[model samples]
Target: MMRFDNIIIGMALSLILCGVTIGAERFPPPDFVETDHVIPSPTVPGPRQDIYEYIDAVVLLAALGLSSYLVLRRRSRRAIFVLMVFSLLYFGFWRKGCVCSVGAVQNIVLSIFDRDYTVPITVAVFFLLPLVFALFFGRVFCAAVCPLGAIQDLVLLRPISVPNWLESGLRLFAYVYLAAAVLFAATGSAFVICRYDPFVAFFRLSGNLNILIIGACLLVISVFIGRPYCRFICPYGVLLRQLSRLSKWRVTITPDECIQCRLCEDSCPFGAIKKPTTDWPTTEYSRSKKRLAILILLLPVLMFLCGWASSGLKTVTSRMHATVRLAERIYLEDTGKVEGTTDASLAFRATGKEQKELYADASNIRAEFKLGGWFFGGFVGLVIGLKLIAVSVWRKRTDYEAGRAGCLACGRCFQYCPKEHERLKKIKEARAKY
Candidate 1:
């Protein structure tokens, strides 16, 4: 397994270097040609692009199915690793990271809220298929089919465990990111998730320099931190985690009864394994009950406070919209607070649009932001309150088990279990007898 991991890492590094070299050559320094009245031509996609998107959706479904089998039935970490490599090649490199589930979240939200927007069937499939699989099979998609996760998984050289408190705190950012992405998409303000996708730069081998730097930094951190982006930042991961908690089938550490060898306890790098817990002491249990009661009472207060605070930031958040920023710029110019007019302002003026109308439109957008902010803040507050409640509560467990929500189903612990090896050896011996 270690050798295979090293080989995959080598191949991935080679591909990255090759992609960078090719990208640098393909996109040389731009030659600025001074010209007057340059006509802009709109480019149209051929049938191939649409066909490719359909193929991508089909491939994604197939990959998810195979990954589920590998993790849940075959119990083959090697097979899962192979699938991860294939996903990185197909979804990451060939697709250039477009039509991806992460970005499709925005498209789906926009389609639902904006009547004029129509989501393509392929994008809908990309968005929904993995979630459906997650509801039944746990996060097999995260284990083997997500190129973003695959890339990070391959680069993980020496992962150190993150403290439980810090890990829990960082996970809150994923929920916040999910809320913000939905808010921006529902309001037709932006696709902030796609715009800041760090791995997309690595996949496409071309992007804004700042984003490229951020991607590089993340990869560097991933060397010591397993799936930093997936665990702490990816909004899509937040959805998967929730669905996986309710999954019907999940990866298990042992094929039979656990022997309490403790080998599998430290095998997982993502801290997904839950150790057996004893009953809480009488004093501690009483104290926890009181704390839970207090937190329950505080939940409503936190929600309202967060909602009010978020709603107050409408003026700042609404500026993310083009119309809002343009209106603000035009207003500054009109009021003589600024000296020169921007191209956008000049274009608006040329359109002969009424300032009154522009201001009204901006006002409506700000109103939407205000409403969305309240929901977003309330959602975040609710998550925080629930998290606090969960920590305050204790559960009794007799055996070490994989966390339903936290496990990536990577099959790392399977190899660490002597029972699993014995089961395999017995099966092999039975096959020989047959």
Candidate 2:
């Protein structure tokens, strides 16, 4: 049987393909491309802003914000809970991607390609809101705001923990990607953060085929591994993790609990719980010693380089690579050496003027790289740095505090709370005895 998603995706693809065909036949490419700012397209009734776009972004943020507030406030608003789920599906996925952070990433990339591009508000919101939240609420942003993380959180059924070494290693990739993207963005090359984002196609409900494939892979991974993207790959998550470390309030395994039954540890689906070690004294002492040793060894070097290296790589490499690739492809095709060559190749026949234009266009590559790299790197650094400073002062922390930056505000806990489940069972048994 086809999964509901398969059916939805199939229908969506069919409708989109049909619409494209009709649009092609009627409108032509030039007609499809908006040339003039003719009244900025009138919006229909509903939420303010573009209806679909606004709803998708608003629903997730609202659900995340409200749900976290309620839970944190120790208030149960059941109606809001229902609304959160409905909105997540309705506004988040079904509405199609509009201003979703995942899609906003693409806008950042486009801004790199076109000099006339202006910074988009959505992109700015996606990048900054978490920082603001992290400062006060301690990763409540992860708890419910992120659409991509929320979807994966909901689908997680059985999650086996990967070894910590492997998990940490995988996590390093996000940092590397963050650094590279920042370097690219800072150099004004492109928004690599947006360009290779795995979730944008899902959010947009339309994008490159490869992106769609990547989104699908993320979904499949979520079912078994529990938000692999957030845990291991999301550059945004790296920023969140850093903020959470110093967050004033972290979700802890309360020390005053009546018993150390370890139920909470078992209930945790995301492997966030860590039982106190059998050799707590030795482990604590050894761990501290190792950390001190490492810090003592590296602190001076980092202090010297952190400020300068963080800002400058002067020479652009990623964009240069992209330029060479594009040039090579163009050169190959122009020489009639392109496989399956046909009349289709006629448009790209290089005039001297066009070649000159293309060479000068290399600036687009470097600009995009700079934008992506700089934005990601500095964003991560500032957020993480803020958290590190906080940790130094607060000295209070918890593992359950939503895995640094990974609280995709899905209402999965509403369904999967083992405590709630056990309570329900006990009530049933008591009723039977009565």
Residue-level lDDT of model 1, residues 1-434, one tens digit each, is: 37898887886787686776433454454555884555668998665667777788889999999999999888988999999999998999988887788889999999989999999899899899999999999999899999999999999989899988999999999999999999999989999999999999899999999999999999999999899999999999999999999999998899879878888998889999999888787878778888999999999889888888888899999988999999999999999999998999999998899999999999999999999999989999999999998899898888778999999988888999999999889989999998
Per-model TM-score on C-alpha atoms: 0.89, 0.60
* C-alpha lDDT (0 to 100) for residue 102 of candidate 2: 39
The C-alpha local distance difference test score for the whole of candidate 1 amounts to 0.91
Span of 10 residues, lowest total lDDT, candidate 2? 392-401
Model 1 RMSD, rounded to 1 decimal: 14.6
Q: Give Cα-based local distance difference scores for all models.
A: 0.91, 0.55
Please name the candidate that would achieve the greatest lDDT relative to the true structure. 1
TM-score of model 2 (CA atoms): 0.60
Error of 1 at 92 (Å): 0.1
lDDT of 2 by residue, 139-231 (tens): 555555565666676677877777645766576677767666545554445566666767667766788998889889888888888778877
Q: On a 0 to 1 TM-score scale, where does candidate 1 land against the true structure? A: 0.89
